[model samples]
Structures are given as structure tokens and as C-alpha cells.
Target: MTDYVAKALEVDIDDAVRRVREISEQEAMNQAISVVGAGPAPGGAEWEAEQGTDTPAARQTAWQLVRLRIELATGIDPFGTVLGLRRMGTTWATIAAAAGVSRQAAHDRWGKQVLGVLDAYGTGELGGPVADDEADLRRGMAR
Candidate 1:
């Protein structure tokens, strides 16, 4: 992708993450509504019962949604460090140090590949617009 496109993707990802967070917050509000509608309780029992059932499911769903948001925002598949490095730019070196690898090694492994694929896919030079470039890359690499 061009730098502009990459930057745009970053913006889009940020928006998507914000939207997901909003949805999660809404979900929490929905749970609260349910609890409120369920009526007054005698000594925390009803609240505890609701908590036992709703909290776990809500928490799990929220976490999963956040994970998806992270994936979309970063454009990096799980275990692929490229998106993080690209997003960090010069700070990638510091990230590398924290990850216990030399900066160059980290860059070599993760830096250009995602952007290269983005460029290829964005320009329609690699077949066509991909539904998901990361998934396409993974499939292409597997073949």
C-alpha cells in the first residue's frame, strides 16, 4: 500500500476499534437494563445470580470483540509482528528490544511483508481486492 493508504487503514482501524468498544459498552448497558428490569432483590442473591450467568458471558464476548478489533486495527494476523512494527515506525527498534531481538532482525521478520501485500492487493496487482489481505497472504504462503 502507499503510505497514504497505510495511514488511511490505520485511521479506519482506529475507528473500528472505537466502534467495537462502543458496542461492548452498549452490551454492558443492556446487561444493566436486564438487571434493573429483573426487579429488587433480597440481600444480593438476585444480583449474584445475575452476575454468575451474565458477567461471564458478557466478559467473554467483550474480550473476543476486543481481540477482533485489535486484529482489524493492526492488520496483523496473530503471531505476525509486522503490523505492530509498521505502526510503530522508528519506535519499532524499542519494541524489538523489548521483544528480545535485534532491531534489524525484527524488521526483517515483520516490517515490509504486510505493507508489501497491502500494496499488491490495493493496486490490484495481486489478482484483485482481497476480502482480507492477511488471510489471503496466509493462504498464498501456505500454497
Candidate 2:
């Protein structure tokens, strides 16, 4: 990808990470508070006696949330990759091929957004990860 596309990706990824962390922290706090407020189950003194506490359940829920956060963070990358392909002069057809969609579908989905970034790139406005040239971007993509 060109510097513009790389920079845009970096910003987007950073924002995604930040949003995930913030939401996860808030969710964790809510879960913790709810767990603390939860008393022994109704008419289950025997079960409570055996289980002791519900900390394990709360911890398990927290672990699930953590995994969800990771998945959301990683899932954002393909958007960047698609934008980068456009910046590198890849045809809409090729992008659509990689995306398992039709050329018109690709354009209908991402053309305007990609065009905006490309315009910014040409104007040297959306400064970002610097690449020497298209060849550098190709190599980076290969890896």
C-alpha cells in the first residue's frame, strides 16, 4: 500500500484497538459489579454451600469477553487490506476476486471510500506508513 493507505490503516487499527479496550473495560467493570451484587441463588442454599462463590462464573464470562475483543480487533484488518489494494493500483475486479464478489459489487461497496483516500494520497494529505513505491507495497502485501 502507499503511504496514505498505510497511514489510514494504522489510524483505523489504532482506533479499533482503542475502542475495543474501552468497551471491554467498561463491560468487565459492569460484570464485576453485577457479580458482586448477585447473592446466593433463591432456594439453593445446598448448591451455594457446595459452590462457595460465583467467582468462577464471573471469571469465565470475563474470559469470553476478552476473546470477543480480540476477534473484533483482528476482524478489522481486511478493510485496511482492501483499501490498500486500491491505493496500489489493483483493479476493482481483482479486489472483488479476492473478496469473492463481482466487480460492480466491489465498486458499489468500497469505490467512493477508496477514491477519497486515493485523492488524499495524491494531495499528500493523508500521510501514513511510507513505502518507496508500488513494488514495496506489493512485497509488503506478499508477506
Candidate 3:
């Protein structure tokens, strides 16, 4: 997509991704609880009412689902980090180094999104001021 279009939709994309991740996380937790009753709380919190059939296979399936959810959620932060780094003028090489990938790989993965963020900033379409701490991170990455 053109940088302008990407920029225009950047916020919407972020919001949509976040919403989906949130839903996935909640669904994973719910499925896990359904399988194993929250697996015995440690802080004296009672488990919620059970929902799914409590069989060994069902429990295993729920566990797998929760694991997959965790993996998917974990993968999203790198996308954000890539955008943040690109926003800060960090070179693709540096970002790739941190990610343990070739520069082309990094760009292939996140370059468009990063470009969108840059476009947003240029057009004054970014929704809010970046946090101070994030700026510090940018500085650190610069060096």
C-alpha cells in the first residue's frame, strides 16, 4: 500500500490488532478455566463456575489453545517495537540485529507498518504524544 493510505489507517490497524489480541487472550483464559477450573488458585481466590466438559483430552486441547494464544500475543509486541524503533530513526540494520534477523527480513516483516507510522507523524495524524520513557528507549537504540 501507499505510505499515505498506510498512515491513514495506522491507528485503526493498531486498534484492531489490539482488540483481536484482547479477545484472543480472554478466550484463551476462558477456555483454560473451562478445562481445568483455573488450575487451583494460589491467592485464595475461588475458581469461577466451570463450563466445558472436564475430560483429559478436553483439558489437553484447552491447554494447547492457551499456549497458542500466548504465542500469538507474544508475537505482537515485536511489531510495536519495530514501529517504535522505526519512528525513532533507527536503521533497519539495527532493528534487524536486535531481532536476530537479516535487515531485509526485518523490513519485509514490518517495514510497511513502520513507514505508516512515519507518515502519520509527518502528517500530524499520530493520536498522542509519545511517552518520555519511549523516547529514552529510542535514544538508547540510537547508540
| lDDT (0 to 1) per candidate | 0.47, 0.53, 0.53
TM-score for all models, in order of appearance: 0.26, 0.34, 0.34
Worst 10 residues of 3 by lDDT: 128-137
Which residue pairs in model 1 clash with each other?
A: 1-119
lDDT of 2 by residue, 32-58 (tens): 446445444656865466475766454
Candidate 1 lDDT, 82-134, residue by residue in tens:
34333323244543553456655654566456457546455734333322324
TM-score order, best first, reads 2, 3, 1
Instruction: Point out the worst 10-residue segment of candidate 2 by lDDT.
Output: 63-72
lDDT, residue 107, model 2: 68
Q: Show pairs that collide, candidate 2.
A: 7-128
Two-way TM-score contest, 1 vs 2, winner = 2
Better of 1 and 3 by TM-score: 3
lDDT of 2: 0.53
Q: What tens-digit string does per-residue lDDT give for candidate 3 at 28-57?
A: 556546655545443443323333335433
Error of 1 at 32 (Å): 27
